[model samples]
Structure formats: C-alpha cells, structure tokens
Target: MTLTKQHLVNTFEGARNNNSPYVFVGIEAEGIKEVISIPSVSFDAKEQFYNNAYSNKLVHVMNSKVKIIGLTHGYPEALTDLV
Candidate 1:
C-alpha cells in the first residue's frame, strides 16, 4: 500500500515499539521511480537515511520521496513469498 508521511511515521513507530524487524520497499513518488529500502528503526535514523539519499545495502535515489509498496518481516519465512 502507498504510505503518506504520517503513515510512514506510524509504521516506523509500530515496528520500533514491537521490536520487530521490517524491511519496506518503496519507489520514488516522482520521476524515475527509483526503488529503495526503508529498514525498520528509529524515526531519526529513517529521516537520516532518507536525507542522505543513499543505501549502501540497497538501491539509492537522490532526494527520494518514498512511497512504500511492500514490506516483509525480518525472517526467512517472511521472505519466502517475496523471493
């Protein structure tokens, strides 16, 4: 599902509160539609990662406006369908 900023914030908070590992995959809201990964973590860290415009472990997009399209919990089973 597409997520707005507030939705993103809430999702991040929920993940953190539950101490669950989640990996979100999104595309740019505008041109190029670059793909990116939003790893579950603190809001500050997510903001930092967004601002930095880079993902060492995943694809990077400059000034990315992430629109989450999918997510998976951190576990082999959770990734089976995705893979």
Candidate 2:
C-alpha cells in the first residue's frame, strides 16, 4: 500500500513532538516500518508544505514545540540531505 499524506503527517507530528530526528517508513504493515530518531535539524511545517499537503493542518502543527522537516522513508542517511 502507498503511504498517504495523512500517514506521513501523523508520523512526522509524533516524531517531532518527541524531538526525534528520524523514523522508519513503510506501507501496509505497521510492524514493517520502524520508528527511528534522526538528528535534529531546523524545520518548519508551514513554510515547507503550506501550499502543499499540510495547508489545512498548519494551525495544529504550529502548536508543536518541535520542528518537523520531513517524513522518513528509509535509512537515516537517506534523510541527511533533506535537512
């Protein structure tokens, strides 16, 4: 199964709040995807995806103390260039 925008948002939100830097991402089987923490990098949900998939959810995300840059789909190295 393909990961939906909502799934990515939820995963990002959870990882963001806990100050996590990385999280494993997969489809269909929840157990297949492991949540891993990545190093912290300055990120903003509104600025990144305001006009994209997160526009409607911007207000809720703004309340989060931690910054969310992007959702992880693979190993930590794959996310290094994203930050």
Candidate 3:
C-alpha cells in the first residue's frame, strides 16, 4: 500500500492508544508503504529482532527509504555487535 504522511500520523496515534512499543514504517522511494509491528517484550528478544532487521541486507537492497522508530522503557547507553 502507498502511505502518505497522514497515514503515518494516524498510525502513530493508533499505536499510542494501543500502547505499542515499536512501530516501523518503511516507505519505498516509489511510495509503497510497509508497516512492521514489534510489541513490548523482553529486552533480549527486542534486541535480537531489531538486530536482525537492522542487519537484513534484503531491506537495504529493496529500498533505501526506510524509517525506523523505537520506544522502550529507558534509554540505555550500551552498544553491542548484535544491538
């Protein structure tokens, strides 16, 4: 589906109301929209998933216009190979 700025706005609002932890909105240069949901889970699980998504070569090859947003419990100042 093609998503405009308004769609993202609406999605964010809905996610906020639903208490969603992560909402990834991917948009292609051509305007195709892809939404990925990452619910609140253990830190390790979330990190693993995010690491996989971040390292997925297919995503980078598919499109360069990708936007990633994440909401967590607290901001931690730690960086690892998987994270």
Which is the leading candidate under lDDT? 1
lDDT of 2 by residue, 1-83 (tens): 33345655665666677766555432112223233343345334332453252324222243432222345633466555345
lDDT by residue for model 3 (27-82), tens: 23345544344444543464444445442332333345553332222112211211
What lDDT score goes with residue 76 in model 1? 39
Candidate that beats the other on TM-score, 2 or 3, i.e. the better one: 2
Candidates ranked by lDDT? 1, 2, 3
lDDT of 1 at 10: 58
Candidate 3 ranges beyond 4 A from true positions: 29-83
lDDT of each: 0.48, 0.43, 0.40
Could you give candidate 1's per-residue lDDT for residues 1-83 as a string of tens digits? Answer: 33344444555566577666664444546444433444554446875654355443223454334334433444334544343
Per-model TM-score, in order, reads: 0.43, 0.34, 0.34
- After TM-score superposition, the amount by which residue 70's alpha carbon in candidate 2 deviates from its true location, in angstroms, is 11
RMSD in angstroms, all models? 6.9, 11.5, 12.9
